[model samples]
Target: MAIDWIGFSYAATLALGGVLGYTRKGSIVSLIAGLFFGALAGYGAYCVTCDPRDVKISLYAAFILATVMGIRYRRSRKLMPAGMIAFLSVVMILRLILSLL
Candidate 1:
């Protein structure tokens, strides 16, 4: 069941890419990043859930990674402008759930 997320991730990314291209005037890369961000968010959430006290470090790491990716690719089309915020939010939320575990 949990493993199904991988397939869902790919499909969702492709679907979002198509939607953005057709409606939001976004490029395929945006969709790809959105999907990638979502997956990253999920992974981050998973990580912090394993250790709540380490959330600060995990979050900082994620931010650094995001910054690096942004610097490496100047094209906004390859990334969702605010996806990092969304990704962080989701990761935090997931971490909260993991904390209760």
Candidate 2:
């Protein structure tokens, strides 16, 4: 089975982001969220590696992240964490959709 490099990278990024959030801001919530979503994404990647057609988990994770982060970006008007993650989530969604086509 081929590895889903992009998916894995995205998962890593999310996990790292969470760690950073906790280290920098001491936000337990961020840590939990980051790890939870990261694990979800990683599992999704594993599913995709086994069968490219299986994108349900990955898509749901990305959609949830994008929606939540997008809202945070809108309210905070900051581009560091929320905006960047939201943008990445959107791009990931697009990539996942394209892979299906």
Candidate 3:
């Protein structure tokens, strides 16, 4: 099987998002869920494109989505969660690296 870097990064973000969703109020959980679903949709969109194109497409989508989520979470004072930042950080960084390669 091929080592799908974008898929791995996407899956990792999802896994970490589950942990980051933890919150007593549950809103953070909801936000992470939103982010997760949004990412999933974007990733699905990326998959429909052809092979070599899919790589850059997925990475760009991933980068944009993660960046937006991070910015949104940071600006919305009420939505910031403990682990979401880390999840975004990892996903964004990985996406950038993969996009470069």
Candidate 4:
């Protein structure tokens, strides 16, 4: 199978979210659950798109996740968890918008 950069990046983003969640909450369960869901969603999105053209769903999810994380970070005053998610979410949103154009 061909390698999908976007998919890989998405997966990485999910894994990062898990890491950040663990660091912020000190809950291994959060990390594992996040990774599991993220990986699943990333792989699913990757397969569904087969390219950058169909990034809407992924983009929407990314945007939402980012927004939520940003808010979470603001409230908790934590940098790593929320910051990382927000950052990646922004990147994904940008990519999605670009893909649309």
For each candidate in turn, the TM-score is 0.39, 0.98, 0.42, 0.71
Ranking by lDDT: 2, 4, 3, 1
Q: Please report, in order, the local distance difference test score of every candidate based on alpha carbons.
A: 0.48, 0.97, 0.54, 0.72
Expressed as tens digits, the lDDT of each residue in 1-101 for candidate 2 is: 89999999999999999999999999999999999999999999999999999999999999999999999999999997999999999999999999999
**Top-down TM-score ranking:** 2, 4, 3, 1
Total clashing pairs in model 1: 0
Clash counts per candidate, in order, are 0, 0, 0, 0
Q: For candidate 3, write residues 1-101 as lDDT tens digits.
A: 33555564555555455555554445576557646755663464446333433555455555655676667766774455433643555565575466547
Which 10 residues in a row give candidate 3 its minimum summed lDDT?
Answer: 44-53
lDDT of 1 by residue, 1-101 (tens): 12324323433553464456546774666566556655554555455455544445435434654465455446554445344433544454454446456
Candidate 2 accuracy as TM-score: 0.98
Among these predictions, the greatest lDDT belongs to: 2
Candidate 4 lands at a TM-score of: 0.71
As a whole number from 0 to 100, the lDDT of residue 72 in candidate 1 is 46
lDDT tens digits, residues 10-83, model 4?
77768777777699879897699578758765864786467656665676677677888899888988776677
Better by TM-score, candidate 3 or 2: 2
| Alpha-carbon shift of residue 79 in model 3 (angstroms) | 12
Off by over 4 Å in 1: 1-23, 54-61, 64-101
